[model samples]
Target: MRLVPIQSVKEGSILAKTIYDSEGRVLLKEGTELKDITISKIEYLNIYTIYINDKYSDAVIEDVIKPEIRQKAIKKVRDVFYNLEDYNKNQNNYQGQNLYKKSEKDFQSVQYVARELIEEILSRKNVMIGLVDLKSFDDYTYQHSVNVAVIALIIGMKMNFHKYELFDLCIGALLHDIGKVFLPNEILNKPGELTEEERKIVQEHPKNGYDYLKGSYDVSVPARIVALQHHERIGGQGYPEGREGERISILAKIVAVADVYDAMTSTRVYRKALSPNEALEYIMANGGTKFDYKVVQAFSKVVIPYPQGTMIRLSNGDIAVVTKVYSQMPLRPDVKIVYSEIGTEINSIMELAKENSIVINGLEYEVPEDN
Candidate 1:
């Protein structure tokens, strides 16, 4: 079976998957055959339509339904953070071994954790407040660190970084914020503005994190350097030593771009969270001064500004939700929107191609209630 846009979907096509409502109501079950009115009415709904034959099965669902496993990995990382005291006693604090092993052992698990983290951060406006209820700040930190590592890894993957180097990059990115453990909770969670002294203290986290990892674990120099120099800027205005330009390691530069992008898109005490596109714009604007230009471009290619499952408003008096992203045109992907022009929910999906259709002039980060 082939996934086709609703516009070209012919009648007699079989339903490939079960259609569910926002309230979890099963609107249509698998094996349901399409009628002409059903297709036309659902076409107005601007939803995704899959053309299926007898051979199509639920194999796709199995691949997409692994959030439970991802959550398990997240819980394990959280445990490490929660039991940092034990970890430290066992000589495991800030050591890069944990980060490296987790990534090497389970790259998919790491990627899923990162994807969930990104969705949560983007959805919630207050980062610290949103994270506070997650039981352990340490786990939150670890999960976030892992998230950043995966982000860097994704960036590196796009740049064709070697597998070993990619693994090292993931390890370094995972441990990039480890020094925050030594920081005072008051300073870290301060809702108000931070003083220069407090800012300086915060800036020391990279160096401190690097020290903790280097001394505790037997990680490579690139991994250690990434933790230390991830904050160093291209214009020699970053933290610790402010080493300029090529003096910084490539891994450090890559992590820096991912780190700042995640931080900006994440909620902070002093400001509201920026949307993904907004944060990317900020990174691009300051590319040469605050970030590496090539890294920023790579990041832009890897991360979709409007990720899947996000709701968007169309010009045709309808609300559409992104269901999938197309590699060729990342911005214009497949969307599934609810419709009831005939007083019945014409549940289906739509593909927004740049070829010929109502142009999607606006985009949103929030998922719709009826998705």
Candidate 2:
């Protein structure tokens, strides 16, 4: 299967992966032929890219969690956040009232999903982190929460967190953005720069989310703190509070990196998504400043910048597709040069580690200006 931009998708192509909405509803299933209507519907939904069948491409992308389990996790996140949103519509938490009321079942449901994700991920010690999930503009929050949790769990495992600590981190990372549900939809979905006043309101989401989760009887304090401090940077520049390095807890620091990585890689209304390599570079660049150094280091060791099936450009001016990924050497994945510089078909696969001279120069989804 080959991933392609929605604009380049042809009507007769077969979907290579199932597309799910925020509520775990399947929009389109794998192997289903994309007709004019389905293509149009996908575009209308604001989905930027998708995976489709390509006879010449042998690249395969794998998810750490099963599709059924991942979908349920997304649904669980939806349930927890939506229920809180519904409850908030009636109560006034601004007056120091506890937000969650009889929320034990809801909290436990999220914990169950988190436990499932942690177990599934830990079982696959070699699972490479790939930014391949399909999500729409409207599905951003629910799906993004799940993806962030997955990424955070992987990074935590790489750093060798204790079993109990991993559970707290997983739940904390999953509900990190639970505050956004209380914010106005207009501001949350705005496609342009925010005014200073608007920015202040947007900044309240972390504390707002913290307050909401703090009142929960089942939610752990460490998990609730993740919602509060995920926005806090190590260099004292982040919002809500200007906390410095070591002052932040290790759990929140880890979730902070995970939160930004997925948010940067996931396409949003305001900006196009950064390529996986590009996002990794950004985290690496700001490791000591905006993010915790240890967390960023763990992120690099765990994630696959170029996963299988990625179309990339080589230094020799040839267009190639990623055929294999080396977890320890993320920048040097084995690639098959499918076409020469002038678009001539070559179909030659080479291990980048052995070919010391040929380097990856570009990504297919790379933004024009970014290139």
Candidate 3:
């Protein structure tokens, strides 16, 4: 299977993986053949890319969290947020108590999903995480929460965090942005520059999330701290509280790295998403100030800088598709040469770490047609 942009998807292409809607409903099932109307419907849903079966590029990118688990987790998180929204709308109603109970149940379900994700990651210590963000703008928050949880868990495992500790960290990561649920939809989704008052409200999400999580009888102190302190920077430049260095809880610090990484790599209302390599570079550059250095170090170990299925140009003028990523050498992954400078098919795989003379120049969206 090969990952292709929506524009490149043609009629009769087979979907290699199931695509889910905002509510976790399957929009298209695996092995479904694409028709003209189906492709248009996919574009209308704002999906940017998809995995399709193809003979030339059959390399499979493995996801640490399985699709079914991820979809269920997204639904659980969405339910919790929707419940919170409903409660906010009827703050004076007696149904508030029952809604809170339902929210708590949803939280428990999310935690269970988190544990499963941690187990999957732990089982495969050698696989570099190849999570691609295929979410639309409307589904960003739900997908992002799950992605952050997965990223944080991988980093936590690399740090040798115990299972219980990993559980708290993952829970915290999943709900770190819960405060945003309280913000007005206009303010949260506004595409233009925010006024100072709007900016302050946006920054208050950490404290708001912290307060919300603190009321839960089952949440741990460390998990609550993650909601409160994930935005606190090491250099005391962060928001809600300008906490610095060790003042931030270790769990919060770890989540901070995951939060920023996912946010940077995801397309928001105001900006385009950064490439995985670009996002990692940004994280590395701000390691000591904006993020905890050790956490960033751990993050570098698990994230695939150049994800598989991306077409890239080599410094030597060859065009290749990434086949696999080596955790130890992220910048130099295994690639299959799909075309040469003369626009001829080469069909050879190269382990870039061993190819000392080669360097990746930049990414290419599509290979140039053979001349």
Candidate 4:
């Protein structure tokens, strides 16, 4: 199965994986053949790309975390956020004992899910994290949390972190933005630029999340630090705390890189999502200033700059689909030539690292449906 942009998807193509809506409802089941109406519906839902079975491309992109595990993790995050929101709405209504019990349960659930996520990522270190941004505007917070956890765990694995360290890192990454649950909906989802005061209010999330976790008994110190310091930069420019250099915890440093990357790549009310390659470049460029250089290097090693099944234009003007990614050379991957510059068919696979004269010039947003 190969991943393809929705614009290039044609009728009769088999769906390789089930598509789910923001509410966890399955919209298209696996093996369902795409018809015009189905395609239109997917497009209407704002889905940009999907997995489809194609004989021409044998490339397979696997999810680092299983679908069931991911769904459960998302649901767990949603539940915790919902509980927090509910508690804020009626803090006086619930007894202290009852509230404490609920909070404990939620923290336990997060730890269990975090361990599972770490194991899943460690089990498949070679598989590039290629999660599609299928989140709806309403569920953005929950989905974004899960995405950060997965990305952080991947980077941590590449750094050879121990199992316990990985667990703390994953938990911290998952709840790094949990404080946003307390922000007003209008300010959190505002489509326009924020005022100076509003920006300061938004920046208080790290402290707010840290305070929330500090009261919990199950959270580790590393995890709490992540919630507090994920936004702290190496050059003392970050918010909540302008911590620089060794002042920032290693766990928070890893989470910070993951948080920034996921935030940039996710679509928001204010801006369009950056492509994965563009997001990575932004992170790399900011390394040692906005992010820890070592953590950024580990992230670059694990993530695929140009993921498989993505179409690209070579410097030679050949349009091809990425067939495979090499760990050593992420910028250049194997590509299967589907069309020449003149738009003629040419079925040939080229290992980009072996071809010194060719380089990917640009990514093709749309490809011929007939191919």
Candidate 5:
């Protein structure tokens, strides 16, 4: 399967991955044929790209979590956000133990999902993640929460966090943006630049989320602070608390890097998603300044620059696809050469770490299928 822009997708092509709607419901299941009407429906939902089956690109794209697990995580996130939205909409007269019970239930369910994700990652012995899971723009926050949790878990695992610590980190990272539930859809999904006032309101989400979690939920202090201080920078230039250095807990610091990486790599309404290399470059550039250097190191260790099944161009002008990424040498992953410089078909696997001169130049999105 190959990820292609919506416009480039042909009508008769088949979908290689499942597509979810704004509410995390399955909109188009995998293996669904992309007819004219189906393609139009996808376009109407503001989904800019999708994975489609290609005869030439034999590489397979795998998500970090199982399909059921990812969907369940997304569903839980959606439920929590929706509950918060409902509470905000009805806080005036709605009073009972029910609210507290629901909040407790939500937090508990979230904890279960986090623990499940941790188990899955732990079972895979040093799992490396890919740049997948781009849902609709309207569902950005919900999907992003799950993705951030996964990324944060990978980083935590790299740092040798035990199961208990991973639980707090995972739960905190998942609900880091819960405060955004109070935001108006117009402001949250605004296509244009946010004004000064709007930006101020946007910056208040961390504090708001922290307050709600602290006051109503049964989460740990570390988890609560993650919502409050995940934006905190290493040099005291972050929002809500302006915390610096060790003032921020290690869990929050870890989530800080994870949050930025996911946000920058995601496709937002205002800008396009950055490539993996581009996002990593930004993170590495800001390491120890805008981000914690130690956490950034952990991030570099787990996130593969080119995940398995990603088509890339080598320095020698050959087109290749990534097979595996080494934790020690993430930049130089194992790749299978699929085409020669002159567009001739070739199939050879090369370990990039051993090949001194073969460098990965950039991502290759458009490879021939009927060449």
Candidate 6:
């Protein structure tokens, strides 16, 4: 099954996944038959196009692809949450170092998933994909982990790292947050400002994660180091160890930059999500202090600061929606001129970077408007 935009959704098509709200309530369920009114109702389902059956191409709207992805993501989050919660309640419940061992084993599995995704993207294969919806904490966690791993892998590939090293980097990134399992759910899901003590606990997760992984047999040294050192700052202001520039491992520094960018741009309980461009701007400004400069530069090159489907305001008082991400100049993507300054439909696609006089001043919509 492939994705089709909601505007292109037809009456006989079936939904591939259950659409949910920020509160975890289901807005629409999978297998629901589409209607024009159904398409017009929901607001945040932008980016995704509907899927149709490949077999008949007409007899059925078999939504096999996205639904499976949604189910997998949901299951992954639920399983991790429960397992972590269980471990959190009993720190010494393990007879030996099983907690860390279990985490390592889990990492081994998820690392494979990360590698497969990277290979699929790199090969330009026609793989099924459902967009990462950032409407929930679980989505933020799972998707950010995957995104960081992909970004790091891409950078590693470009830097000419061997296959073994790239695989290790994938392992390092996927397990970077495995220590968050040790923190209390209240702190992990805290919606308000965290106290100094709470902030310290949050910061200690890296070392805690590393220690746990190190205790387990068969875990690579780089995996443990990455878990511990991903928070180290280049300018010596980061947490846990606060190691200076060269002291921090190169892999850790790379993951550190990718982690911060993905987290800041993703939606969380505390604040509304920053646009991808805004997150990149924040990263670029703090590169020398909070992150490695070269890593940040690499990320800027690979990640689309203005990903497709975002709405932007132009200097000419026109409003447009992003339609495609170009290989060059990620900050300036191709946009569809959806509305004029007065909110009239233009139905035209405009290449912003190629346009001679137009300039995008800002993004106005944090949440996408439903079709």
Q: Model-by-model lDDT, in order?
A: 0.60, 0.83, 0.82, 0.82, 0.84, 0.64
Cα lDDT of candidate 4 equals 0.82
Query: Predictions ranked by TM-score, top down?
Result: 2, 3, 4, 5, 6, 1
Per-residue lDDT tens digits of candidate 6, residues 42-77? 423432334333221222222212434434433443
lDDT of 5 by residue, 1-371 (tens): 77766877888888999987655568899999899888988988888789988654666877788877888998888899988788878887667546657688888889899989998888887688677576678777888899989999999999999889999999999999988887778888898999999998999999988988887657889899999999889799999878889999899999988888888877788998877888898999999899889899889878877776778888998888787777778789988777785544477788999999878887776656633
Give the Cα RMSD of candidate 2: 3.5
- Which residue pairs in candidate 5 have backbone atoms (N, alpha carbon, C) closer than 3 angstroms, thus clashing? none
Question: Which residue runs does candidate 3 get wrong by more than 4 Å?
Answer: 95-102, 343-345, 354-357
Please provide TM-scores, in order, for all candidate models, with all chains considered together.
Answer: 0.60, 0.92, 0.92, 0.91, 0.90, 0.73
Candidate 2 lDDT over residue span 1-371, tens digit each = 77777887887888998987766778888989999888988999889889988654655677779998999998888888777777768665445544454567888999999999999998996666886577778778888888888888888888888989999999998899988988998999999999999899999999998988877778899999899999999999987887889888888999888888888888899998878888889999999999999899999998887878888888987777888888889899888766675444477778899989988875763312212
Stretches of candidate 1 above 4 Å error? 1-139, 268-271, 314-318, 334-371
In angstroms, the error of model 4 at 24 is 4.1
Question: lDDT value for candidate 2?
Answer: 0.83
Model 6 weakest 10-residue run by lDDT: 55-64
Q: What TM-score does model 4 achieve against the real structure?
A: 0.91
lDDT of 3 by residue, 183-280 (tens): 99999999899999999999999999989888887678898899899989999999888999999999999988888888887767787677777888
Give candidate 1's error at residue 179 in angstroms. 0.8
Candidate 4 lDDT by residue in tens digits, 1-371 = 66566787888999988888665778889989999899998878767667888665556667778888888898888888899889989888875646656788898999999988887877774756564545656678888899889888888888888999999998888888888877898899899999999999999999999998888878898999999999899999997979999999999999888887878777677887777778888999998888899998999888776778777878997788888888778888988888775544477789989999888886665556554
